[model samples]
Target: MEVFEPFLAGIDNPDHRDRVEEIFNWVKTRFPNLMPKIAWNQPMFTDHDTFIIGFSVAKQHMAVAPEEAGIHRFSEEIVQAGYDHTKELMRIRWDRPMDFALLERMIEFNLLDKQDCSTFWRK
Candidate 1:
C-alpha cells in the first residue's frame, strides 16, 4: 500500500481515488508476492525485478496493461468480459465488476512468460 500513496495522492477526485484503490487492493491481495511500485507515473507490479502488469486511470476506464502480448493472447476473453482494449492495454469500466480471475491468469502468465527476462521492460 505504501507504494500507492504517492500516486493516489495525485488524484483529486475522491471517487476516482476510491476506485483506483479498489483495483490496487485487488491486485495486491490477489498476488501477495509481487512487488508494487510506481513507474512511468502508474502503478506497476513486478516479479524478480521484471514487470508483470500495470494499471492506470483514465477518464472512462481503469487501463490494464499486461504489455501487448497479453492483450493479444487474451483478446477473446477480454471482449467477453465486456472491456475495451488495444494492442497494449485494456480499458475496464469503473462501474463494472472486474474479472479478478482473468486478471489473476494474466499476471500468472506474465510471470511465467517473462521468467527469463532480465529487465523490467522487454528489449
Candidate 2:
C-alpha cells in the first residue's frame, strides 16, 4: 500500500480513495508476487517487470486497464459484470459493485498469457 500512497493521496475524495485502496489491497494481497508501482500517474501491477494490470480514477468511474488482450478476452464477462469498456480498458462506475472474481480472472489470464512476453506490452 505504501507504493500507492502518493497516488491515493492525489484523490480529493476520501471515499473514492478508500474504494480504490480496497481494490489495490485486494489485488496486492491476492497476488503477493505482483510488483506494485505507479507509472504514468496510475497504479499498476507488473509481473517480472511486465505490466499485468493497471488502474486510474475518474470522476464518475474507476478505469481498469489490463491491457488489450485482457479486455478482448473478457469483453462478455465485463459487460455482464455491469461495466462498459473500450478496446484498452474497462470503466467501473463509482456506484457499481466491485467484481473481485472477474478481476482475479483478468489478472490470472494476464500473468499466464504474458509469461513469455519480452516487452512491457504485448508485441
Candidate 3:
C-alpha cells in the first residue's frame, strides 16, 4: 500500500526502473494535480477522486490500464504495436518498453475527459 511501492517493487531491471520513473515524471509534469496511489497492489493515478490509470508488472510484461475511453481510443495502435489489450488495459512486454508518445496522449485525454460523478453516487 504505499502509493509508489508497487511500482518500485515491480521493476526488476534498473533500466526499466529508470524508464518508468522518466515516464512517471513526464506524466506528473502534464497532470500536476493528479494523485498517485496504490490500488490492487499496483501503481495508480487519480484525478477528481476518480482513478485515471494504473500499472502493474506481469510475468513477462508491464501492463497499464489507461482507463475508460482511452481503452477504445488506443486499441488499434496497441494491437498494431504488438501489445495485448484487455477491455480497459494494455500489456507491453518487458523487453519492449511502453510507447511514451502514446502513453502521454492517453493520459492527456483521460485528464480532459468529463466524468459522470453522479454515477458513483448512484452505485
Q: Of the candidates numbered 1 and 3, which has the greater TM-score value?
A: 1
lDDT of 1 by residue, 1-123 (tens): 898998988887788889888878988898899999888888999999999999988777788999998999899999999999999999998788789899988998898899999988777
Model 2, span 1-123: residue lDDT tens: 699999999999899999999999999999999999888988999999899999999999999999999999999999999999999999999999999999999999999999998899998
* Top-scoring candidate (lDDT): 2
Per-model tally of clashing residue pairs? 0, 0, 0
Q: Residue 99 error for model 2, in Å? A: 0.5
Q: State residue 103's C-alpha deviation in candidate 2, in Å.
A: 0.3
Q: Each prediction's TM-score against the native? A: 0.92, 0.98, 0.78
Candidate 2 overall lDDT versus native? 0.96
Question: TM-score winner among the candidates?
Answer: 2
Candidate 1 vs 2: which has more TM-score: 2
lDDT of 1 at 33: 90
